[model samples]
Target: MTSTLTAPVQPETVHAIEVGVMQDRIIPEPVGPPSYRASYVTRDTAPGKARRGVVLALKTWGLEQLADTAELLVSELVTNTFVHTDSRTVGVVVTRTAETTVRIMVLDTDRAEMSVPTCPSGDEESGRGLFLVAALADRWDIERVSTGKRIWCELDTKKVQP
Candidate 1:
């Protein structure tokens, strides 16, 4: 596993930053409060920094644990886009519910059905991205968009601070 460090900000300070970020950033209008979004394009290169930034942003919401899990989720999602879908444009959004649950959604161009991450044989080299996401995320699912598809996984921090 890759490693990245996020400067720890106090919960109150992080909460404030989250509010400011949401206020300054453009957000889609949903039924309830608009969710925060972060988008990136995948490539043959790894998506480590992008994943780290995402984890930091969510840290402001006191979802540090969720953010940690999200790093893996986002990495897998972005990596999958590069591996499975030929498209490089990948978008990720972090949506929170009134119940204080956060969902990470990754959008990629290939609407032609997707596959779940299954455990590879012990000696095998790979095929465990989705498996990690499945284990870390509370729940996950996929949806078809007008252009491509969006794969989402929900993480429940269980702490409703923000």
Candidate 2:
């Protein structure tokens, strides 16, 4: 995707945002590669389980700074698997790829259309999942895999000296 910034579109232009990061977050990224993976039978409880798994991974890797956002993204992605697709299982992987970047991938056995981000109205509650994903993740995408499709996202944090 290519975007050309003109005079009308300036980075400093700001208005009231419904939701956003309240303050600067520093990741304190780890020194080496660390990762965690889990596969679950998709059910109503899958989202909660996935959130726990992500929290554990973030904690184990000493990236607790990312726990809140990471877990929420994982829950959203995992919930979409069982709720929108016929797949019985969902696979989640959390990998720390760099000193300041972590990637999350949710795989499911469905080749359905990739999830789309949307602007939901104030009164609507159901359509905001993907929107939240797009809003919070530094980068996110979906692609076709052999078994199905994978929706992934990355969350980057700044390194802070202690």
Candidate 3:
């Protein structure tokens, strides 16, 4: 009698683990300027904590003018993660993609719960998070992964013209 041998199981590798809106898209190192990134574990106070970190990073990158809007956007994303997902942790990343643009991404671990952003009626108190994100952000998109999804938005950091 003869027996067949089985191969060992290999752990899954996260090929593209950085923050961005594109699934499976590898983020190369910033070629022109330095970028800012931070990750935080999910908690009751995660939104505030993430906001503070983002504010600091934006200031450090000399994008202070975008602080208020960015802070609000980041807070909304973080809140969505904790309020909607069963994720244990969340990743926050802020990157200056161009002289006048900055990208922010929030990653969480709840693949099955992902949904497109929706707008709530004016009288409604909730469901307006993503609506605000789309309004304020120059562009926004979502990316799904093996573990979960990432919601990302890009802002034009340049001063607006009247």
Candidate 4:
């Protein structure tokens, strides 16, 4: 292993500081959001892959109670990208916004805006992803960006049951 010495980190200049995995950064900091991001190939397994990442990050942050709901919601987002877009890969982010709140984001490379989610009838087999997200998440949204669309949902630990 090669080690190189560098200048000390001046608090104001470093914008993307990452705290150790097990440690929580003090709230109200100027650093980037505390998030875990992973990219998975767009395919049948993408949703599960995204879910596992969410579960792991939540558990690491000692927010185990949010993991299950977070997993289900994020999987829906990931699955949407895989099924609806021409994206080759999808990005998933699990962000801890507070001691009791978390945000999940799914991004893809297709620029088309997602159709407004509708609650399907009981006999419908498809179109339930966003419905599940809307019903389960504390809040959720869709944004069309330059590269593609970003779909995100938030959940608070206190609102979820273990």
Candidate 5:
């Protein structure tokens, strides 16, 4: 007769987890000095509400030229956060630079690097948001944050040039 023995399973096993930290880097920069500022905080719902709020705020601040572009940019940025990131709080900041420029920033708890917007074959149903941002904004880019990332763009406010 033959007997076989098996080793006991270990009681403790080490587990490895990957943690990511948000880094801040400016995507697009404003052309002039900072002037007006507005911030919006909301849950991970839809981005339309936030976009509308920003549009109104910019309009009030006499940044009408940036209104349409800002709305579209905000929509793209907020949509990206709500769709890609976890269900965490999202915030947006709209800053006026000089008298004819505005900067829109969308902040989220996502640490992944942002890719430039693309629409494959122009027939794709998604991935076109950033394209709109590029067309409307003078310049745009992503900024890494301590806990997430910020998507930003600059637009002409259509204000009287000094």
Candidate 6:
């Protein structure tokens, strides 16, 4: 009898494949109140897709007035992940923490060893993403994780006028 052997898969390779698989799957709508989540590949259009998803979810939850600001914040966060890191994909989650509060989180496979967020000068062409997030979000924070880092921002949706 003869046997054949297969090559061993490296952990990094497995992780990369898993991320790729995740990018192709559709993000399911939140089952209960207060949350929506999605994943996207790192591409020029990823931010737009993410923004649309968040806006749609907000609308479904009767938060139409908050769509503009929420979309903008989501775009900024998603764009930053695509532009600043070598990560091939990113994940976005929107959560309603309270009747008036909504939180947006973007996850990327980049480590926290990178530079922190900073405000750019007038002459700069870039580096203003986080500054915009700070201005628009009621509160924001970044946390490092085993796989990557998550940047989150909160908005008071109740303040939005119809």
Candidate 6 residues lying further than 4 Å off, grouped into runs, are 1-22, 29-32
Residue 69, model 2: lDDT of 91
What is the descending TM-score order?
Answer: 6, 4, 3, 2, 1, 5
Per residue, candidate 3 scores C-alpha lDDT tens digits across 38-146 of: 5566766778877877787778777788889999999999998898888877878788888788999999988775666666778988998888898999999888988
lDDT of 3: 0.77
Query: lDDT by residue for model 2 over 1-162, one digit each (tens)?
Result: 999886764433122222233211112223446877666777787788778778987887788888999988999999889889998778888888887889999999987776555688899868787878898999999889999999999998674332
C-alpha RMSD by candidate, in order: 12.3, 19.0, 11.4, 8.3, 17.7, 9.2
Give the alpha carbon lDDT tens digit for every residue of 50-151 in model 5. Answer: 666677666667665556667778888888777777735566667775566677878777776666555667677887777777877888888787978878
Top candidate (lDDT)? 6
- For each candidate, how many residue pairs have backbone atoms clashing (under 3 Å)? 0, 0, 0, 0, 9, 0
In candidate 4, what are the lDDT values of residues 1-162, reduced to their tens digit? Answer: 999999986553222223333221112224576678776777787787677767878887888887778888987888888889998778787788886789898988997656777778999899888878888999989998888889899998887666
Expressed as tens digits, the lDDT of each residue in 107-132 for candidate 1 is 87787776655679999877887887
Candidate 4 local lDDT, residue 61 = 81
Predicted structure 5: clash tally: 9
Residue 106 in model 4: shift from native, Å? 0.3
Model 6: per-residue Cα lDDT over 56-114, one tens digit each: 87898899888998999999999988888889889888888888998999999987495
Give the clashing pairs for model 1.
none
Where is model 6 poorest over a 10-residue stretch in terms of lDDT?
Answer: 11-20
Residue pairs with colliding backbones in model 6 are none
The count of backbone overlaps in candidate 2 is 0
Model 2: runs farther than 4 Å from truth? 1-32, 159-162
Model 5 poorest ten-residue lDDT run: 20-29
TM-score of each: 0.70, 0.74, 0.75, 0.77, 0.66, 0.81
| Residue 103 of model 6, lDDT score | 91
Q: What's the true lDDT of residue 43 in model 6? A: 83
